[model samples]
Target: MNPFDNILDDEEIQELRKNHNHLRIKFNVLSIFTIIFIFSGMVLFKREKFPTYLEDLLNQPPNRLLHNINQSNRSNYSNVENFQNSLVSNLNGGKGTIQLHSQNDYWRESPLFDALKSGIISIETDCWYLDGQDYELFIGHYKYQLTNYKTLNSLYLGNLNKILDDVNSYNYKNSIEGEEKKGVFNDDPTQTLYLTIDIKNNPELTFKTLQQNLEIFQLKNYLTYYNTTSNEWFKGPITIIISGENIPYDSIKNLTIRNTFIDSPLYEILDISNQSNHSEFELKYSNQLSIFASSSLEKLIDYRSSSLSNYDFVKYGLNDEQIQKLKQYISKAHELGLKVRIWDTSINYDSLYNSLKTNIGINNKGNNNNNIIWNQLKELEVDLLNVDNNVDLLNNDAMIAAIGVSNNNNNNNIKYHDIEDNYNDINSNNSLS
Candidate 1:
C-alpha cells in the first residue's frame, strides 16, 4: 500500500474539500475587489487632473528621472553605444560650416553629443554651483530646474575628453603630416571648440570646480592656453571662454599660464576709445587676458526701435559713423591681436527674431533681414558672427554666393567667421535674459 494512504476517512475528506473550496472562493472575491479598486483609483486620479501629491506618487521630474536612468545599470551600455555611433557618424561627415549654437530650449536632447554630431563646435551653458550635502556643479537655465545628472562633466567635459581621445587615435593611425590629433571638426583640425561657460553663481567656487574637474584634459595638454612669459599662444583643440557674473578678472589674471579666458566688454571698449585724456589713460584691457571682445548688438546699434529693420541696418550696419567706431574697436583689438564678436544679433529660424521681423519686412521667399545683417557684418569683416540657426545661417545659398562676390568697394575674397550667438540669452525684455 502507499505510505500512510488511510490517514483520513470519507467524511473527514469531504470536510477538508469543503474548507479548500471556501478559501478559493474568498481569494477570487478578494482579487476581483482589488482589481476594481485599482481601476477606480486610476479613473479618479485622471479626472482630478493630477494633484501635487498624485504627481509625486505617479511621476518623477524629468531631471530626477534622468538622474535615475543615468545611475541605473540597464541602459548604460545602450547610451555608450549610441554616443560612440554618434561620434563615428560625426567624424565621417563634413564638419558643418556654421557655428551652431544649441540654445537652452534644445538642452533636453543629448546636449554635447547632439550639437557635436550636428558639427556645432561652439556651445554655451548657464552654469550654477550647487554646494550641499552632495557637492556638485549643475547646468540649467533656471535655478529651480537644476539636476545632478546634467552636470558639466556628464554633459560636456567627459564627452569632450572621449571625443578628443577618439580623434587623437584616428589621427595617429592616419599619420598625416602635422596632424597628430584633431578637434571635433576633423575637416578643420586646428579649429578650437569654443565652450562659453556663463557662470550664474559663485564665480570663484564654480570656476575652481571647473578647473579641478578639467585637470584631466589639462594634463593631456588638450586645452588652449597663453604663455604670458613667452608672449605666445598655444591654441589647443578646446578653448573655455568664461562669461557672465562680472567674471573675476583678478582670478584670471593671477594664473601664469591659463586656458580659461574672459569675454571683454566690447561696448565699454568703445567708450574707453573716446576718452578725452590720452596722457592720463592706462590700458585697462589686454588681449593676452581675453581672446574675444564681445558686446550687446542692440546696444552697439543704439536700440531705437524694438525691431531689426533696414533703417536699423543702414543706421547701424557698417555706416560711416558705425563703421568708424567699429573700425576703431576692431583696430585696437586687432592691434592687441584679439577678435571682435557682437552678440544679441539676429539668429535665423529663431521665432523671437522672426516675430521682430513684422516691421523689418520679410523677403518673398520668407527670408528675414538676417541676411542683410550677415552680409553687412561680412563687409565690415567682423571676425565672428554671433548668430543662431547656424545650419541655415552657414549654408544659406544667398550668403554663400555673396561670400566671393564684390562688396560696394569691389573687395574680392570676402570672408565669414563661425556664428556663435546663443539666442537663449535674448529676453522678451530686450536684455540678456
Candidate 2:
C-alpha cells in the first residue's frame, strides 16, 4: 500500500478526486432535468383532451358501464336500478310529434337503454327459438349473435318486470290511496312503452315460448291486455306487439284475454278489409287484435320495382304520388284505431357522403336528406318514426329544430295533430289512388 501511495503525488490525487466529484454532480443534474422534462411532457399531454380511443372508453354511458359491472357481479340488483335511474333521468318528459322506434334494440342492453334515454317510446327486439336451446327465446338479429345471457327474459322481459315492480312499489308507497299504477317513465307515468318482439324462427313454437316467458309480467298485470269478456282494452304500463313474417295470428286470436297483440301489415290493411278471399287470420285483423300497423317504407310506397332504392327516399325526398300513397296507408291504419310505424328509413354512409358532396353551397347544417325525409314522415303524420340511429338524431339540436319539437317540453301529455283534418287537407288537391 505504501509503495502505491508513493507512485503519485498528493496534489495529483487531490485533482483526481475533484474531477470525480464534478462528474458526479453533472450526472445528478442531468438526471433531475430528464425527469422534469418527462413529467412536464405528461402534464401537457393530459391537459389536452384524451386521445379518441381513450375518450370513447371513458365516455361510455353510465348504464353500459354499470352493465359490465353487473355482469361480473350477478346478484347486484342495485346496478339494474342504477341503469334504470340513469335512463329515466335523461328522458325528455314529453314525446315529440313522431315517436321514435328503435330499430335494433335486440343487439344488447346498451342500445335499448340508449334509445330510451333519447326519448324513444318504441323498442324492438328480434327473438329466435331453437329446438335445443336452454332458454325459451334468444335475442339477436341473427342466430350466430345469440348468447346464453341474451335470452328474452334476461335482456327484456325480466328486466322490464323488475323495473315495473320497482316503479309501482315506489308510487304506491309514497302516494295517497296508492297512485294509479305508473310506468317506466317517471316524468310521463301514463306513457305506455311499446315492446315489439320480432319472431325470427318457428312462429308458432316461438310465440308459445314467448307466452311462457311473459307469465311473470302477465301475473303482475303490467301488460296492456284485451279482455274479450268486457270487449275492451285495459291500458297498462307496457304493450307487447308481435312482429315478423308469418306471425301466427291464430295463436293470439280467439283468446278470452291476451296481453300480446300483433303488428298488422300496413300495406295490406285495406286489402284485408275489402277482400273476401283473404285468410281467416287476415279477416280477423282489428284494433282489438293489433296495436301497431307496420311496413317498410318501400313496401308502403310500392317503390321496390322502381329504379331508385329505398335509400333514395332520403336523397330525393318523397314525390307527390309517393306522399299520397303513404297518406292513404297511414289514414287507413288510423281509421282502424291503430298506430302506424314506418321502418327501413335509414340512410347508408355512401348516400350521406353523396348528399354532403352535392350540397356544398347550401345551408346543410340540419337540412341533410335524412332530416328532409324525417320532416316528410312527420308531415305525413306517421305515429312512430322507426330510426336506426336515434341517439345521433336526438342529440343534434339543429335536427331537433328541423323536426319541430323541443326535447325540453315537460308537458304531461304528448300532443299529436288530429289525423283526420291533417289527412283531409293533404288530399284536398289530389285524390289518393
User: Top lDDT: which candidate number?
Assistant: 2
lDDT of 1: 0.57
Q: In model 2, which runs have C-alpha deviations exceeding 4 angstroms?
A: 1-87, 90-98, 170-180, 278-284, 307-312, 346-370, 410-433
> How large is the C-alpha RMSD of every model relative to the true structure?
12.4, 12.8
lDDT of 2 by residue, 76-182 (tens): 44533643443243344344323678887754235455655555678998989988863469888888988676677766676566556544543223334212356
**Which digits, one per residue and each the tens of the lDDT, describe model 1 over residues 79-135?**
334333333334324534343344441253345554554455567788888877134
For candidate 1, which ten residues in a row score worst on lDDT?
Answer: 424-433
**How well does each candidate superpose onto the true structure, as a TM-score?**
0.62, 0.68
The global C-alpha lDDT for each of the candidates, from Candidate 1 onward, is 0.57, 0.64
